[model samples]
Target: MEEKSGSLVEWLAPLAFILCAGWLTWHLPAFTLSWFPPKDPSQYDKLSALFARIDVTDSMTGLFGGYADAVDWAALLLLPVFGIIGVRTVRRAPMEFESWKPLDRLAVFIGRLTMMLIVLLCSVMIYEVILRYVFEAPTLWANELSLWLAGFVFLCAGLYAMQQRSHIRIFLLYDMMPRWLQRVCDIISTTLIVTFAFFLVYGGYGEAFDKFYRWETFGTVFDPPIPATLKPMVLLVMVLVAFQAIVNLISDWNAEPVIHTAADDIDQDELDRLRAAVGADGTGDLDVTRGSIQSNTPGKS
Candidate 1:
């Protein structure tokens, strides 16, 4: 029963995100209009008129420009899916060369999501091109949506880099250090990361909250709440990165040092597989040729 439940959750998580993503893509135009509906007679004064007309404090018909905001609903729906996946990931033991922690899993998921957004970004750009050149009708939302998704992609990529241990490090002198010294270096590096994350969250909290509370919009025709959403997201992901660094440091503290030499660099298993595939005898070509040469030499009867 437990196993079945776990499997169900695993299956449901990605399905939920996929369905929500598709729904958002389908209704993107409607959501964009909700934030910035068409106005009559005055282009510049439209936002002012919108604010005057819709009471920002009203919960049912206001905040986020009212119930017409389909984007918010899509986001809300995805929250639980992500939450389930995150919990499951964190509960699992760490894998070799892969952190099975919630932070790593979340970063990976966000990375994949960023890829999906790239598809959406390309689609929007292509659509905009066809509209502009072929139909001579350009959209105001396409560029802004692309920019929004690109920002998220870059942010998510930072987290993914941390998870993969692919971020820049000066390993020249560090590689030569003793294991104890290496562990000390790891501690110091992780401490610095944690400190930076702490400060970011501490200093940026008020601004993030303010933007979110006001449901601040970009004032453009599309009127995305980029600042409100992205500021908090950046700080949150940085915190996750800091935690991952700490986790890595602890996990690797007792690990054996990996020394790389020319002989050790070659993958012998891969060579053996290649030799097997080519139907070579157990001995290599060089050895066989040398044996043949020795046998054919003049002296021996």
Candidate 2:
């Protein structure tokens, strides 16, 4: 029962989170921006834009007519609910966490979110393919939607990778260095990352804000705010990556140094499974080394 509940939560939570996020993206700002007077010559001039960027008046119509914004309220509710579930369900992945404390419930959640996004992206593409090829009724939204989801998948995965310490690193020289020197190298790398994030956020914040405020979009028939959403996300994800790097540095400060080699890429469990499948006969010639699998044509060395 517990496993089933966890599986369901993992599967549905991300979908709900994405839907709620999309709803909030459309409706939340409309209310929050109420302090400022409405502007003219807006992107909301287009019907597609209006749908993408729900106006204060438009949001209250239809099923949401009785409430301030039914969808928005629901979105607000579901976002935190799923997020809390994520936090609760997250487990310590010590292998990935390595020297760090693995206080990465948030990263685990986003990692699941990325998994969900990949599913959604594939669904969108498959939908597009079927509709276009079979039914001859393609959608204008599907391509842009895939692109939009792909953007978040990349960003979220980066943060998750940071938490896992799985991001690419050339440790050849660093592994040979003394502990103090390795610490210095870590500081330098972290500082560079922080510096880059700072400059990028500082410089691009204005543009991200402008795009978000205007609800700038791809201008296709679907007219998604890819520019608005992804621009801000780039800065947001960079900050997160930088923060995670700092956390890693702090947690691993007193830890012994780690060395990497091609052998690290091999999965013992996977080899076990493969050997089981191949049987004892073929296993005699099977060898795993330097991240490569070697075999003889059975009865040969």
Candidate 3:
């Protein structure tokens, strides 16, 4: 699953890149407008004269011209596609563990929390719409509020997906392997995913730092410096997720007695005891009748 984790990091790297790009656009919205703006503009030059030749009329044309709004919304739509791809990948695997550890439980709890938050966000939006259309008393905060909640949803749910292990896979050969071969394959997969996640966090640190320094904010009414706030959280969650993956991988690899599904339901300890009583390979002078209980006396072995 480390490879899957790596894939997710790769998928999300673009979003981080776009965030940095938004910062650039925020600083130089007009620079992007010209096919090639003059490298040097005089202090006295009018802003209009700079773009005088271009006939761009959209709201995003002018300096600070709502480009952030457009990009942010576009990203909001694009992100979920990658997320969906990551999720479907993991759902294809069979259930691995019979019981989960503490971190696994925590991940499930976080998932539930995020689900509730989404529901709450939807309810708020519905109420806002009713207020606007029915009574013509629209609130300015609703839209911004939705955006804020959306940031949380995006971040928290991504972590939840990691815990759920529903990321992508190239399992063309995995299904064909023997049980021991499959275990080895799982070990390799887990190692790769952890490695990838480590590098993702390492590489993203600089971009996240730059965003934080700028105190980056959404342009609209919410006007929160959410990029700065949320970027670090994403990195942190990735690290935590990587740690959880490693833990789960280790547990799976080093589990005691190697439980198997096709084996009978009898306790291994009891089976071993019966085997000892019956003699090595059951070939020596013991009763061969079926359904006969062997008598156990003190010091029989």
Compare the candidates by lDDT and give the number of the best one: 2
* Model 2 Cα lDDT, one tens digit per residue, 1-301: 1122345666666677778887777564554343332356454344234543445456364343332356566777788987776667655443445442444667767887888789889998999999999999999889898999999999999999988878989888999999999999989999999999999999999999888776677888877778988999999999988988898889788987878778788788877766765557774333443233455469643
Better of 1 and 2 by lDDT: 2
Candidate 1 segments whose C-alpha is farther than 4 A from its true place: 1-15, 18-78, 85-96, 259-301
* Best first by lDDT, ranked: 2, 1, 3
What ordering of candidates by TM-score runs from best to worst? Answer: 2, 1, 3
lDDT of 1 by residue, 27-136 (tens): 33334345644454363244344444443332434236543443456565675766567345422222214555555566666555565667767999999999999999
lDDT values for all models: 0.63, 0.74, 0.57
Off by over 4 Å in 3: 1-98, 168-172, 254-301
Better model by lDDT, 1 or 3? 1
Lowest summed-lDDT stretch of 10 residues in model 1?
285-294
Query: Residue-wise lDDT of candidate 3 within 1-301, one digit each (tens)?
Result: 2222224444343344344433443333244323333344542143334233222333453334432344444544555554443333322123333325666655544454476568768988998999999989998778876877788778778767766655555555765666678778877877886788788888999989766544456666645556766787688877777777776676666544333343445666666656755777764334433344544657654
TM for every model, in the order presented, reads 0.63, 0.80, 0.48
